[model samples]
Target chain A: MRVTVNGDPRDVPADCTVATVVAEAGVAPDERGVAVAVDGDVVPRSRWAATPLNPEARVEVLRATAGG
Target chain B: MLDPRPDDLVIAGVPLTSRLLLGSGGFTRLDRFERALEASGSELVTVALRRVEQAPGGLYDAIERGGARVLPNTAGCYTAREAVQTARLAREAFGTDWLKLEVIGDRRTLLPDAVELLRAAEELVADGFVVLPYTTDDAVLARRLEDVGCAAVMPLGSPIGSGLGLRNPHAIALLRDAVSVPVILDAGIGTASDAALAMELGCDAVLCATAISRAREPERMATAVRLAVEAGRLARGAGRIPRLDHAQASTSDAGIPDLTPAP
Candidate 1:
């Protein structure tokens, strides 16, 4: 299946979960201070394992960065 | 000797002793950022959300270690939808509902789109986020933000990172008077005096980043900003004398000695 991760187009397994896409986007499973959203709706950490990604889904993996 | 403790700045029901809010950006190193954070005495610090191509390492951890509350900002978002989504993601990531909303209208000036900003502010407020919008120095917009349940109205003194200082003190003063919510003077602060002037104009607080983080001596500049905020707050409470068109004599004619030449 094709999905847009952090605005970048990529291919992933058809049955991939939110957690799988998160890890595929370079976010370690033990990484702290990261959040994921699918099509603009936040996916809580507890639900990442069960939330399945739809084809052409937009996944945004955001983390804290130094800013003013 | 005015006391700011009696009038603590309360944002979204969180009472804070220090009215100076710092931005955790532009620091060359973590240690320097920590030093500046300590010296500034700010209770809230702003951070941004971005893609994690590379790990942030200890950056966010360092900010947490400083003991100030984290305020995530949507700095790069240009549209209302993007800003709203960013705020939601920030809330989930940071575990805080506080957001510094910034919806840029243009790239060159990095100015907020007033129409989009208002739309985002309204939406975020309805979603239960404590929105503190970075807006222009306009009284009407400040009122509108307050009306929409924003926790505070942060008006810029000038363009972001321009270091222009408060270009329109009167306009800021008007904003201060027009809104009941806390008036935080955000952006375009270059030095200690600029921060002081903001407080002197009756602003509830002052927020800055480049002024301290990009300084030659960030820690020293941080301390300067701390003192300036306190002094300005006290000055405002102390009630300054009204300006006059003509000078007034300090000495009395009756007390003057008759040593002048005879007329």
Candidate 2:
């Protein structure tokens, strides 16, 4: 399936879950600071495993950063 | 209400002893950031959310180690919808609903879009977030933000990172008087005096980032800002002497001794 991860178009498995996409996006499984949003809706950490991404989904994997 | 123990900076029912909030940006290194954070004595600090690829790692852990409440900001988001999405991501990233809402209308000035800001505030408040928006010095807009259920109104001193100090003290003062919530002087603070001036103008607190993090010595600057905040708060309560157009001597004319050289 084709998906947009962090604004970059990529090819991933058809059955990719939120957790899998997040992991593939360079966020280690032990990293708790990362969060995901697919198609503008946040996928809570608890449901990362259950939630599946659709083709052409806009997936955003973000983490806390420094700013004023 | 921040002099005695009972007096604290209470926002959204969370009491903070330190009113000087710091932003985790522009530090040279992690140790310097930690030292500055320790010196700042900021109970609540601001952080930004960015894509994992673009963001530097370990800021969250550093802030956590210092025990400051994480206030995630929508800094780069220009529209209401984008800000709302960023806010949601921030909530999950930081595990805190306290948001420093910034919907910028311009790139150079970095001023908040009052229309979009109000819209976002209404939505976030309804979504159970304690929204503290970074707004202009306009009192009417501040009131509108308050009306939209924002926990507090943070009026800018000047533009973000401008370090220009309070551009319109009157507007800031007017906004302070116009709103019932805490008035935090956010941005464009060049030094301790600016922070002091902000507090003297009746601001509940001051938010400084570049002034501290970019200083030659970040830790010392933090301490300086901390002292400035305290002094400003004290001076505000102490009641400053009225400004006089003419000068007045501390000593009486009658007490003046005789004679200069025989004029």
TM-scores for all candidates: the values are 0.93, 0.95
lDDT digits (tens) for residues A1-68 of candidate 1: 99999889988889999999888877778766788999889999889999999999999888887787
DockQ for each candidate? 0.65, 0.80
Q: Write the per-residue lDDT of candidate 2 for residues B50-133, one digit (tens) a residue.
A: 898888788888888998878899999999999999999888877888999999999989999999999999999999999999
Off-target runs (Cα >4 Å) in candidate 1 are B1-5, B261-263
TM-score of chain B of 2: 0.94
Fnat across every predicted model, in order: 0.76, 0.89
lDDT of 1 by residue, B148-217 (tens): 9999999999999999999999999999999999999999999999999999999999998999999999
lDDT of 2 at B133: 97
| Weakest 10 consecutive residues of candidate 2 chain B by summed lDDT | B1-10
DockQ, prediction 2: 0.80
lDDT of 2 at B98: 93
Off by over 4 Å in 2: B1-4, B255-263
Instruction: Report lDDT (Cα) of residue B97, candidate 1.
Output: 93
